[model samples]
Target: MSQANEKTDWLHALLLYGLGFLLFWEWLRPLSIISDTGQSEIFILFTAFLFLLSYFQLPFWLSFPVKGIAMVYALHEMFFPGSFFDFLWLNYFLSDFSQNVGFLFDGRFDSLSNVFRTFLFFILLWLISYLMQYWLIQTRRIFLFLLVTIVYISVIDTFTTYEADQAIIRIVIIGFILLGLLQILRIQEQEGVSFSKGRFPVYWLMPLVVVIAFSSLFGYIAPKAEPQWPDPVPFLKKTTGDDGEGKNGNGISKIGYGEDDSQLGGPFVMDDTSVFTAQIKDRGYWRVETKDVYTGKGWESSVRDRVMFEGSTETLFEDDVEVEAFDMKMNMTGNEEFDFIVHPGQVTSIETGKDVQLLENPLTGKVFTQNLGESVVLDNYNLEYESPTFSEKMLREASTEYPERLADTYLQLPETLPERVGALAEEITSEEDNPYDKARAIENYFVGNGFVYETTDVAVPGENDDYVDQFLFETQLGYCDNFSSSMTVLLRSLGIPARWVKGFTEGEFVAAAGDYREYEVTNNNAHSWVEAYFPEVGWVPFEPTRGFSNQADFVSDYSDDEASNTETSDPAQAEEEQAQQQEQLPQEEAASGSSSAPFEWSMWYTVVLIVIFLLLCYVVLKNYKKWLKRLIISKYKKRDDDKALSEAYFRLLWLLDLHGIKRGANQTLREYAVQVDQKLRTKDMKELTRRYEENYYRGKTNNDGWDEMKKLWENLIKKMQS
Candidate 1:
């Protein structure tokens, strides 16, 4: 091989393996695999293997389509959780700016940017892999760079991950594989190898496995350290920022609650992971953080002040506010440190095993606790709530006097909120006189309209879009957060004070003793509900979400109103009238964009199909020579024994040439066979040379035993290899 070809081969090998290293680092370092248990690592390994196989089958330039297609899918998954499978264009990202020809520079690409972003990501992965490979291989100084990178990531992962669940094992195994690939490339460079000539040698793989085995054994026996860094991941907030429940932890929550991702949040998935178990009576949802500030992205709890409370006191309800009182006790689980999931009512007194700091928003009665030490035994806590008794009759007549301070804090709205939100709120509450009626009107819109209440997959709002506005006027699909946050925003838009509250649901009533009821609350029961505050009535808990028909006396009010509307009408054709009214609501919902066009998913299966297709291509490339030889054997199979002898003789010559002992162009067949006999130090090819001369020049048929010639041919092949 020429020096230039050797240089290119080394570069190709370096780029191919080096890119694998970078991709592994980018994926593993930033994210925690504890929840996933190395799921992301498995995916990385699969993609890398697929990538290398493609490198072997196609020329470097065409390899992009093989990997780039999969990357586009990944990018789609990032922007919209449920949409990696959605294809062509999902109208959400097709904003005004992205339609231009420039693609990246104009910045108005909106959702369309995802396509370029993924393509650009693949390009970057491709370029950096090649660039690093070429630079390192050219300098013969590649291993040190990879070695430092491996150590850096190992140390970071060591210090960063909280659980550290078998991640080091993955890292160690990956290091061995990478080192093996690097050395294999160096070996190829030494041999001046070319792929088209024949099969690659497998001799280097033995040492690779041996080294990996020893390294893995050492890893198993290494001494462990008591981690001094934070127990929780440090860069967690950034990593989980996009698809996370901010305070609650990673993965989807089922009990229909999450950490304020959005009003119209990402896909709702059920996490059956048990969040906690609660023992209580007077079933009501737990209220933790009340997000008073609404950014288009999601809800934010602006109440950062922590009031240190001890003994029988915590700043909860104001003295003047009247409420019914009830005492209760419960324990919090260790899914994460308990940040206080309390009922909607105020805590009169509380106790805990760990020293706790109490934080409360008196106006909203939303409370939080900071645990001093990581306690595992569901630390026992007791508290009395100054709860309120409410009926639709009492709430409608209750005073709407706005406290100046309370009004400023509770009625907060995002400034970028569209005009349609306030307009729609007014339109819904046009016939209602009181704030209670107005709140009910907005809540009923979600329950009675064509809105869907789903826990696993919810509507994803567009960029620069207000979550509440999107939920109300556009896509009427979501879980508890969507329904509750929209109702709160609508209530605030109508001058009614409402806040989004999150915590566990009252939970399934497991067993009851005397006055109290025992309930089991899993992470699946994490729920969000709205608190619409009335001046004399205090903050009344409202279950605005459709599927959750409990935790409120007011939820049944809308059902009653629907029934009473017909009874009071005294119409002869009441059934027909009710059916007509129901039909009108869904029609209005459709006009308001409650249902979007059903997504026409491009053949997303094509990514998988393409992977399979490329794999088949690799298989064909790997075995093409063998298949071709079989074809040649069959072609000569029908002929006589002479042709078989000639075929065997030619194969020996080809093997010799493949092994770089090519016969000179000017050499006759006799001369070549004689030279091979000398190289083999045997008389094997001398008899074969005499037979070939007779067959070719004298046209003499070799009727003598062909087995003897075959043995000679086999010996010559073995000799040339040695």
Candidate 2:
């Protein structure tokens, strides 16, 4: 018996590990780079780690800690760094808790080095925990195995909200649970510990049924919870560039510890932080960078940094000129209060609310804070910047005044240029007469030709002076930065002042406000475009980025019909009718009424209906069983007492009904009994009727009577069915 128990325990543990391996395999498979070439190496590493975790077996105490660490690690990757660990821990404890103090500490401590460290620590912790339990507690190994399996699963679920979409993980977890139950059942088999081993403890199935029923109910009724926003408390924000290192409020040095903080080489001064967020009616663009002066390396603001006029409340320059209105606002996410004015470059007037004040720059008339508070209110104001026309004409005419440093840097060409690039440029721009026309010709050429837009990781700096030559002639794959950088250098070689422009393109609109949207933006939306100075126009925007191109024909000629067809049809049709015959047919209705119903349910409607009906019948039977179980049966001393007689009378009547007997509506109990007895030719009919009278009047039904009645009724059913 001992040996059998030991074997069963080992088998259960192995099964549990096997189940874990399946779950781990699933987690790795969908996410692994091995599945798709586009996936990152880091993703592949993670999948491997998960596989190892599931394949290996450890004691309950050890597995629990390892699972906890794994869950935390997963959460860490999902959320902002160091943000979701506490929640992960909470989820872990909700699932399992069984670890030695030292083991727990050791497991967590060893998690410091790298990804593998956590796994190693978890293994050590599990081994130590198992050792402690084996030597000190001396508990049954079978029970230990059972406990470990339960704890490991509970921990996995608590930390990760398992979705049905991840079917493999779900199946694996379910397998572990079944294996654990099987182990417990095995122990009971040897020891005769079951509540009703002979009867099969059919009630044991009740819990699973109840759980599944509830799960099905939730699946059917639960609504999809949409994402929501937090509280709308107005916050003050100090404006900083994408790299975060920008000038402070006092403009002494860059502030806010921006993305370029390392480039700053030191901590930012607090005074450099300015309250830039302003309360407005809508969203508008804030022009933080103006690339005017171009050296070969980069662009900077022109030397004319003087303010034009004192703070003017009006945004319009002239009274009669019709102006385009672009109203906007900002929602700050930090705490700092101010009552200063805020306006875009085209503001014309002021409309201050409460204790707000507008302090314009003495030289340029640009707005700033007067009291230097955190939160501020800016009213109507009119402003303007140097137009693209003026910037271009100035660049063309002022050749002698050009910065000396910009000569070699911006105009430098590659030593070994591909002659094809120059030929391609010349061919594309052969029709255009001037430099501006030629530049436009080059941009149009790329947009119309076989050029593709995509991001690439390999952007090594050129060894020679001509980076543009390398990009245009050699590697054709690169991101927005590469494209614009190449374009700028090409234009400059033709004596046009061009520079790379780094800024986000237009943002996605927020329809709720009946205008554009905000807060939906993320870090990935940052972009790069090119700015070329024309003699007539200052610096015209030339967007060669992926999504911002103005060339319409180059984009795939996708019609609404095409979109509909793509969505509705199979891939085969998409190939056959590539450009036409696009239409979306409404999807066929599901049997259960929802679109998300599995295909099986739609295919087997009759079977599903039958199953549903059976389920309803079972529920009604279960409820009726509860009422029957509530009836108090008692033992009788007499062999044939009034209670037994009464039960026998009812049993006979019930038997008649099972044999296609139906009592007439007009017949009383005694009458029905007489008719039944007459059909059956029973001699004890009168006595049975008298017993029924006694049962109703004297109330003498007990356990013996109920048992006799049940036996007789069951026999009647069997006979009728047969």
Query: For candidate 2, which ten residues in a row score worst on lDDT?
Result: 261-270
The alpha-carbon deviation from the true structure for residue 202 of candidate 2, after best TM-score superposition, in angstroms, is: 14
lDDT of 1 by residue, 190-226 (tens): 8875554343434556677778878888868889788
lDDT of each: 0.59, 0.40
TM-score of each: 0.45, 0.34
Candidate maximizing TM-score: 1
Q: How much lDDT does candidate 2 score?
A: 0.40
Kindly report which residue stretches of model 1 are placed more than 4 angstroms away from their true locations once superposed. 1-28, 31-62, 79-103, 106-119, 135-138, 142-330, 333-378, 381-418, 422-499, 504-689, 705-708, 716-722
For model 2, the stretches where C-alpha displacement exceeds 4 angstroms are: 1-286, 293-323, 334-427, 434-439, 448-456, 462-465, 497-499, 514-519, 533-539, 550-722
Q: Assess candidate 2 and give its TM-score to the true structure.
A: 0.34
Superposition error at 184 for model 1 (Å): 14
lDDT by residue (476-562, candidate 2, tens digit) is 544555567657656765655665544333333333333323322222334456655443223345555432342111111133433
